[model samples]
Target: MSEYQKPLPIIEFQAQKEFWDGCKKHQLLIQKCRDCGEINRRSVRMLCPNCLSGNLEFIQASGKGKIYSFSTIMAYPPQGFQDDVPYVVAIIDLEEGTRFRSNIVDCDIDALKCDMDVEVVWEDITDEYALPKFRPLKQGS
Candidate 1:
């Protein structure tokens, strides 16, 4: 097996389709409710979590955030992740006032901390898809 095997996402549903489409283009898209403007950052649902509005629009995110909380996985990772055992999984608080759960890459896990600034880094795993990962923002950036 290859040392670096990336797992592909299941994009059989419409929501998955839209999300993956944006990722393929290196764009970060999030759903915002048309009625209440509540940004649904993590879960993909048909209606708004706030007002139960079925009108949700996908908008491009700024791709900037801070690590609210995180965990460093050094062992016992799931399938397709065993190759990347020492990785950071963070709940990022986006500048747009939403939170997203993503992997934190391109940095030492020991340097991670709560409220540390981070920026999105796209990992081109497949010809038709890319995963949106985050990394620590450089000083003075």
Candidate 2:
């Protein structure tokens, strides 16, 4: 692939390292609290939000979710994303009961709607990183 000009994730800690590593392998990972059984969508936190416990483990997510909300960017695109204007950014509510923000792709922007099913699609932007984006779920896999 060509050199990616977009900003990439800054992996500063171990949790972030594990998260990026999982993404590089096309695996969607979330943090599960060992103390309270709470699953956190963000892996950057050292303590569980539900329970103050540092005992957390990484678990692979199914990468299936529904669009909780979305917005179509029609103007003022961010730096390095000028070519990707009119894209859809969405908040996905994963089946595992956590939500995260990702871009929706491979579908018509006009056809987008809330509560629509979606699944993970990786963008292997570089040799060291593979970002997970979402797309409308196909009728049959």
Candidate 3:
């Protein structure tokens, strides 16, 4: 069996379609304000938070980033994610200057650092959804 393990949460929302779609193909995506050119994570609105312009775009992410901040989850997730307890949940600072909230999997969780170099990975949680996680990119994958 693969070293991966997860019991995922139920994601129900119409706005997150594009983000979910990219994950199916192992691609990370983020929102860009078509008006001011600012990047963000959640697909919340058409208006740019910075300039308040109703123009936005979803762009494919580079899948490379650094650990901006993180916390080791000691408690169980609301419904799913019991087996994966004690895992590291982190906010990654992308090279593009936006932050992504995802888990750092596939290695010792305690080994992570505040500015560690990490790469994106797509974990297929179901037929219709994939979760973007991170793995320590070793010398070779």
Candidate 4:
């Protein structure tokens, strides 16, 4: 593929490293607290946000979700994203009970609706990185 011109994630810590690695392998990983069984969607914290325990593990997510909310960007596109105007960005509520933010692709923007079913689709932007975007679930899928 052509070089990815968009701003990439800054992986400055071990958790970030692991999270990005999982993404490269097409896996969506989230942190699970060992102490309280709480799932932390963000991977930056070393301690469990729910129980304040320094025990956490990465778990693969189901990657099936519904659109909690969304917005269609029609103007003032960010740097490196000028060609991708009129795209939909959404907050997805995953089946595993965690929320994730990603762009919605491969569907009509006017057809988007709240709570619409979606599933993960990877864009291998680089050899070492892949972005997990969401798309409307196909019929009977």
Candidate 5:
């Protein structure tokens, strides 16, 4: 393994495991409230934000979104991303009205723009783990 791979995020609990398991399967999963049909992307609260009910389940997301905002990383890389110093980190607003932060890959950093259409691309970090990334959608795709 590479040095950067040694310090990966720990999936310790059931909630975390469930989320990461979907990643391993190359799927973008989001928590949905059964009570209110609300989708929770960033928040991990057990209760539904709309109905205050404790019935939530992870479901496959559409894997489509637009870039809300972004930053280019040119230095001082994080432990697992040392090899990828020059990269784009972005907040993507999904079509489902939820947003999540992830790396923007497979495109020129200089070409990135806010509101650019993007789609999910999985980075298989290991046999049991994957990272959900985004890439600019092609014009005709």
Candidate 6:
């Protein structure tokens, strides 16, 4: 997101800061389950959902995933993004076995499909904020 699409000021807390920092570094860090070694998707919690264990750590992702599901958002986006309507907003299933909601950019939106290979792309919207987006990875061409 750019300043225009996201014209509204974003409220941030400690966790969000750390998360954006990771994206700036081009590393996808999500909470990992210490009990069964599962990746925590959605949002991080103090304990693992599978085991109720408070043992969790941040793990770097491979930055590779597949589109599990998505929707074409034809309506107006946040603010600066009004020009890019009819875009793909999708849930990516990372190879490490976690799903995250992210926008699919850098490709033709109409060509999007479920299970298409994708790679992470970080959009630094502001000095303190960055949004993680995904784009379909091209095969050997």
Question: What is the C-alpha lDDT profile of model 5 across 71-122, one tens digit per residue?
Answer: 9999998676787789898999998889999889999889899999999998
lDDT of 1 by residue, 1-141 (tens): 234366678766687689889998999988999899788855777778889888988989999999999999989998878878888888999998888999999998787899999999998876777889999999998
Off by over 4 Å in 4: none
lDDT score at residue 51, model 1, on the 0-100 scale: 90
Question: Candidate 1 vs. truth: CA RMSD?
Answer: 2.4
* Evaluation by lDDT, superior candidate among 3 and 6: 6
TM-score of each: 0.87, 0.94, 0.79, 0.94, 0.88, 0.80
Q: Which digits, one per residue and each the tens of the lDDT, describe model 2 over residues 5-112?
A: 899899778888888999999999999999999887564687898888999899899999999999999899988888999899999999999898999999989999
TM-score of 3: 0.79
TM-score of 6: 0.80
lDDT of 6 by residue, 1-141 (tens): 344345533435555556667876767888887788877775857677878887877888887999999998889677666787878889999988888888999998778899899998887776656677899998971
Q: Give the TM-score of candidate 2.
A: 0.94
Lowest lDDT sum, 10 consecutive residues, model 5, at 1-10
Which should have the higher TM-score, number 2 or number 6? Answer: 2
Clashing pairs in 6: 4-80, 5-79, 5-80, 5-81
lDDT (0-100) at residue 102 of candidate 6? 83
Query: Model 1: residues >4 Å from true position, as ranges?
Result: 1-6
Cα miss at 51, model 4 (Å)?
A: 1.9
As for model 4, its CA RMSD to the true structure in angstroms is 1.3
lDDT of 3 by residue, 54-119 (tens): 677778778998888889989866555776688888888888887888889887776888888899
The segments of candidate 5 whose C-alpha lies over 4 angstroms from its true place after superposition are 1-6
